[model samples]
Target chain A: MREKILKAIEKNSRIDLKELAIMLGEEEINVVNEIAAMEAEGIICGYHTLIDWEKTSIEKVSALIEVRVTPQRGQGFDTIAERIYKYPEVNSVYLISGGYDLLVSLEGKSLKEVSNFVSDKLSTLDTVLSTATHFILKKYKDHGTVLAKKYVDERLKMTP
Target chain B: MRNPLSNKITTIKPSGIRKFFDIVSEMEDAISLGVGEPDFDTPWHIRDEGIYSLEKGKTFYTSNAGLKELRQEICNYYGRKQGVVYNPMTETLVTVGGSEGIDLALRCMLNPGDEVIIPTPCYVSYEPCTVMADGVPVILPLKNENQFRLTPEELEGAITEKTKILILAFPNNPTGAIMEKSDLEALVPIIEKHDLMVISDEIYSELSYKSKHVSICSLPGMKERTIVINGFSKAYAMTGWRLGYALGPELVIKQMIKLHQFAIMCAPTTSQYAAIEALKNGDDDVVEMTEAYNQRRRFLMNEFKEMNLPCFEPFGAFYVFPCIKEFGMTSEEFALKFLEEEKVAVVPGTAFGDCGEGFLRISYAYSIDDLKVAIGRLKDFVEKLRAEK
Candidate 1:
């Protein structure tokens, strides 16, 4: 039931509780309680809309920064990851494998703003050694959804 | 001008869905819950395999029985999933689609005047295919009370001295009915006693909701007499890829391959290559799609219950056969009026067969958002009809 609920709401978090219950063939009260428990247990962390900011009038630039950081005497990559992720501009922080120790993704108003943050803020950090930043030019797909033309049903209205 | 068609072809009635299709096509801005195919595009990985095959210049006519690798994969799939074994070299024949396999099987097995017992409401091709094969079609109208599964008694009564084949399609279309192992077990004795052959179309096998789909051929002594037809269309959302296959005794399969060699030569080479990939690594895709379909199925069933509409709970396929008998209208009348009034198109039950007259075959292949809007309109339409009554 936990997995089922997560799978159902994973694609559309805005699914109505009543409809979700019906879709899962479970009682409404059970569904409500189960979701509440899941939320409290931190199984469901948060819900956010998948937005294509490029379509909007506002200016936005995003970059993925791979940061190599030295581990402190006692504290490891987690301490440094927390320090980087605490910034408001950082959308995601991950301890990635291979050449990089941490991958931090951030959004800014312009490429210069993003680059400045990398050089001035990220590079100045005590544990930070080197950083490689890749700015995203276009998004063909995001969050498992195609960001281009909307899908139109091309199937005939009726068929055998 | 003289007729360009053959007499036998002329005698077969046009598909009922075809007529409804014409009417619905003219109605602009109508929301339809009437499609018989999956709404999902072919999974990307499988499509990528087809593209890769093309890039590698693997474009050539495969053997009439299809690529040996594909045949081996199909056999492996059935063996792994259904516990049914077949020889890849001799017992498997891939064709244009499950539709082609159905026609091919009928053409190969039926002699002139041999009777083919077909239970309705089923996919619309069996009767016509039987006719085209010069075999008499015996329509066995399944009862809604029976949940549309054919009973042993029903099978025994339908068989006649000339009855040579029983076309079994379950996880059925239009009705969404499935015959369980016990259901198939009960019918096996009767079939063997009557010396009947079976063409089991398990195209919708992956879509069964209540339990794992039980193929009739898996039962003891059933495989040698059964031609199990399945394909990538329904399971892998590869309908447009036009790939399907048959597994059975080498003798029957050899005949199907012979006819296919002359008629189709081979299914699309790209589709065959893609299907090999689908069989090898497509289980997760099938599970994901099936879960999606099952969620929508539960949603529709609950909606019907809330609307006070009587419908048998269907465990297979993406359709719900809801009885609209309380409205005191034929299924066609209800469907046409629903389309005209609400601008939501649903296939009339009579489109499947006369036994489907009081019901409507509402497909759950669309998204829940679409289903919610369509069902909202249906609630209004049903209420309006009740008020008129």
Candidate 2:
């Protein structure tokens, strides 16, 4: 019964407690409580839609940006990074140790807009020392599946 | 001593396509169009050369960068076909497959937090590989309205200061989209202005229809910034042969080769020999096989229309991305139900990315007999689903 519920949740994350109880021949209260426990335990990670973003026409742009930064006096990497992250154009930020100090990734409407953000918004920030931007050209694969290698492996077994 | 499972490895979800394929593998005697490989066998002449090389005991590893002969052949092949040429010794480094070439290219170019722009709905490796390289993968979702081709305006919109590399896979996989020369012309100026590196995977270079495949490297001043990745997999029916090559500036190839040497040593010797043969005499084979795929392509498109699945005709590559959202189920739910009810295995589009949620990628690499059976099963499955309601 637990396995069935888990499998159902894996398939349709947004399944209501009532539906799950009906499918599992269990009480709704019990199913809801189990889901609550799973969420509290972190087993139920997230409920996500397989969004077809094209329908929205939001024109969202995504790019990965490499940033180099120097820590400011009396402030550490996080402090400066926090300031950079506060920008509306910056989507995600991480401080990585390697060829660069802080890695800043952002999205914007145009190349000039993104470039200007770097020059005007990000680079001028107190601790941001340098930024190297690279635009994405094409994607062959994304997420966990090789869209091209769908069933290339004839030997992969079914989820029984 | 310990059960030796690392947290990182355990946490990463397995490939969703592979997961579905695993399910299909358990069924008894189901004809499938689920495979992503070419239906044609590797050309006989190429196989013979590989066999001959083994008979002659050329069994040792080649140089870390791969055999000099294969690189030169690749250079000549690209020049003859795609109007791009790189110094074989300096610019070319043969890899295990286009897959490895992509991994190595990302690893070499990206710093821990660097950003990589990836366009979708696409093949599945770019974003994951970026993450593994400790780089952020920013996805720019392409629309079916544009035939799933990435516009230059879209490319320009996706760049930011932390962007380190752009991976361009064309004569694309799932969508069968190709970037014509005109598209490349539109994209070059932005790339030039940004001083960004372009990794172009043209592994399906020879499989295009309606227009020839265009290499970003063919554009003026673009060669220096572009890394052209190709392999014998799709065109020459050499998927298992496991040979591919990446061509780029010497510096970039050098770093990539260093990573390749440490991690992989060299591509398989037998496969390398087969590739040399493929590079030399595989064009006619590619032409023949592509012709067959095109025929199947037409058949599948008509089937989708007749079945009322609403598919866009693909211009290149072997797969069709058919919109399946009308089924009122997510792509995964539909794929699973279709497999269970009809026993016809197809990949859910959501396996590619979020934008792919409402569609399915149907490969034409299966024989027409198998495709016919699969399509029939799908028709029945849809009818049954409707009837039950």
lDDT of 2 by residue, B9-114 (tens): 5655667687787787778766566677876667889999999999999999999999989889989988898677789888899999899999999989889888
Pairs with steric clashes in candidate 1: none
Which of the numbered candidates is closest to the native, going by highest TM-score? 1
Give the root-mean-square deviation of each candidate in angstroms: 1.4, 27.7
Query: TM for chain B in all models?
Result: 0.99, 0.96
- In TM-score terms, candidate 1 sits at 0.97
Model 1, B108-209: lDDT tens digits are: 999999999999998899999999999999999999999999999999999999999999999999999999989999999999999999999999999999
Error of 2 at B150 (Å): 0.7
Residue B224 of model 2 has an lDDT of: 87
Best by lDDT: 1
Q: Residue B17's C-alpha lDDT in candidate 2?
A: 83
Relative to the true structure, how large is the alpha-carbon lDDT of every model?
Answer: 0.93, 0.80
lDDT of 1 at B226: 97
